[model samples]
Target: MIKVVKRKGKYLVRQGHTRFHGLKLAISEGANIPKLSVILIDYKNEIEEYLENLDGNRSNGLNPVGQAHALAHAVSLGYSVEELAMRYQRSTTAIRNMLKILDMPLELQRLISLNLIKKTLAIEIMLKYSNDHKMVLKHIEGFLPGVKNIETTTSKIVGIPEHNAAGAGPDTLNKGGPEKKNSAVTRKTLGIKRLSHKKTERLKSEFLELVESTHTESITNTQTELKFGRDSAHLFKNVNSNNVIFSNDGVQIILNDEKLNILLSLLNDENTAIIVSKPKLEELLEIRDLLKEY
Candidate 1:
């Protein structure tokens, strides 16, 4: 499809330049192509035009980094997530998911762009690990598909006999009961006890570090608070008790229709000293007027 823009009193090709050129080449060779499709779009400014141009170019899809960049650029151009969703023909949730990619560490982004980490895997890392760059990277490093397969195959290759090679049956290997016997058998067959205690302690330490790092680094960044978790739990405790919180996005309240009507009824009382920001007040006033219309 060709998107044309009005320029110099003529409809000019704004998108699908390659397709246009291909058609032109076909025409030059006397190939009969009677059908053509075109779409005309109007934009008030160059930024809008450029944004559409960028959208047109993304029909083939983008890598995770490019997706994040595009979403970020659209936001920088004063587009809301809802607006971007409409423009891109996507759900607001999808647009928000793309925006989340921007909050990831640069190293993770590089890995994603390089395709060393799949986008689905990266998203899994983000959701499971949150904002811990080191832990995410470490997990990626230790994700050995081939080695895991080999280990499983090797275990099957070394078949288990009625008695172990050391002449120890399940009953003889563990006197601690069935669970213990199973555990003992697994340990003996896998030779897990051969790993040094020092190495085990080191692994435990690294795991604790990963957990601590995830906690510390995650809390300091307000992105999660802005996204999934509401910010300042202690500070907003009182506000939450009222079942509502005012934010830059506007007021979000947990109220039934009856409760909302009761609150609206209270709005007309002379003693109610409601304090709200200008934008919020405007929204409330609009709502009040809208209620009158109903």
Candidate 2:
């Protein structure tokens, strides 16, 4: 029986001193020799489970599955796939795709496990250019954080930036004002405005539908009230209510005494308009008319 024992930060057999001494001498001469551990596990079932776990399931002993799993695991643990694959004799493409699973934000991975995203699509996204991949991942993370399968996630990610995806000139697409004017002129010359209004209306309908489809709870609301009351005087009072009072502005004001004072100070400013409910469409149209007049 080989007696396994620990000595000088290494595991060695007591009967194999000659071999151990040779290894120690090699280490002393600056050769890199790995330290070893000798564990005497008593549970047969536990040992079998461990053996099964370590088994690569390779028929021809190439162990591609084991290598792939190892590459994936190493990437998840923060080891760069390029470095590990270089050392382990695996293709960089395989390593990279494996690492992409690790690159998925934790929240997205949970969705993926739940079948929200397809595996093929996720792998495709992982293989995209770094910047494009990151942008797609960010959009997905924001909108469909709990998405599980690949198809849905891919569709959502691609759709978010579809406008930018058109190989149209970047300046024409992104730059506003004068550049947009030039582009419009060019479009008119090329007779590209054939379905312009129809396209605009379609986009408008799509935007409205998208907004309507979203959960209302995701939207936030803020209310502001303006009172036209005199100093220390109760403005408008409701007939049926005692504590609840109305303001002369035809709205209920629910401000503390201090806030009321600040609001009064702002009300006195000539340049300010008390905008209510995001400025009505009529008000916007009037502004446009005034601009046209100018």
Candidate 3:
């Protein structure tokens, strides 16, 4: 049935657009048409309900980009995304992705028309090429033919300018302008100070004493017969600093140097404890569980 809405005696197509076109063609060819079936809807109110069927039926012959343009048009006509999705029988995310196609450069939109790129690939290229359709086309023309996967090919685009990296390009990067006063990052900006060699050695000695006084007794006495979990294959233990010790069963971990000056400043405080490694904590937890069970 060719669905339509009569507005001021002028019938507007509401559904079955393909059927209506075919019916017109049949009439033009002198074919005898006795009965015509059509459903006339209220033009003022039912506009949103059946908008997808107005242009040759969205589910049948309309390409994705075409549908995206239609969706964009619907959005411009004061229809909400949710309303469009429901009327078009599409998920909200899918509808949004489709609508995104309309904003893309025409070349990328043409790829969508050619069925070479769908929503996912279009988005990937949008981010990867900084939405530069010329770069996208160059990549596709130069590399996409011999390659089977477009994403893997595009990801490996080498010798490309740093401008193409995600969210980091153009005005954000070095633009050959005068550098700002605080442009260079330093430890002072990161809440850590640049310590002199002698001061650093002094802090390390004090931290070694602190670790020894805090953990020597318990760590030396810890011996577990039952090991429920596998030991981590790689531990980030720096063995060079004898003055900064964090040893667990012969594995020594180094504390971050940024906190050294702060820790040395508060060495005499009684309530501050520095818990370091996962193995030590897990052993303590297992001991607690065993105590509860007993």
Candidate 4:
């Protein structure tokens, strides 16, 4: 005979229904309905409290365990998957994937729990190295222990530019190249033991003399009264022969040491110049003499 019993909101079969029915038909026997106890437990509240406690204990409070428990609670609390995802700053797909990690190995789960691996890297490892998970774990164990010295390691791995390695650029390279070659040639030609200060001064003097002799005629013409302004009788101002006048065409004579030094400095720099004021022609001539001595 079959008998049906209801206990704690669940049904249980105690005996065969057919046999119970036959026995009741033959004897007119009455069947007893067992008392059912409804013991109410706040399961939802208990689950929520457990999840919240787990979340508080997790590294970054965003690990898989905490996330799964929270998500499950959210679902039980009548939140849609999309709504739960939005609340947790994740995509629905990511939430689903997090749920999937619940089936991964315990070591990997512990790695996630301890924050040894970030979520993104952990996801990458799982996707690429799942077949060789042991090897991947070994790599992480061996390599990821210390702080990385990125700058030094990168410099060593990738070399610096040859010229820039010594803190020089194109301008320095260009200027230094000729002088470097010339110094070697000069030492060979003159049989100099070393480049002494006296010898350097002498070479500079000779170079200056050569420059002056080459421009002698031009300097002489600068002394004459040249035309200034419109067609006139006496607008011919005397060229400041002592002052050095540097123009796009050639040098003009003014003759001050300071002004000559300024012009030479500008010329050495290969920079453009602007005329501030007119200079004395006599002072500039004296500078020409001084420059010749270097």
Off by over 4 Å in 4: 1-64, 72-80, 86-89, 131-135, 142-294
- Candidate 2 lDDT over 238-274, as tens digits, reads 2343333554435355554544455666778563423
TM-score of each: 0.41, 0.23, 0.42, 0.25
lDDT scores for all predictions?
0.52, 0.40, 0.50, 0.42
Name the runs in model 3 displaced over 4 angstroms: 17-35, 45-52, 55-60, 144-294
RMSD of each: 24.5, 22.0, 22.7, 33.0
Error of model 4, residue 116, in angstroms: 2.0
- Candidate 1 C-alpha lDDT tens digits along 42-159: 8776557756666565444456666666567667767788988898797676676667767776655544554445554455465556457767555554542221122212211121
lDDT of 3 by residue, 205-242 (tens): 66555544543222233322211212431343443444
Tens-digit lDDT string for candidate 4 (261-281): 455667775666544332333
What's model 3's lDDT at 14? 56
* Best model number under TM-score: 3
On the 0 to 100 scale, the lDDT of residue 110 in model 2 is 35
Ordered from best to worst lDDT, the candidate numbers read 1, 3, 4, 2
TM-score of 1: 0.41
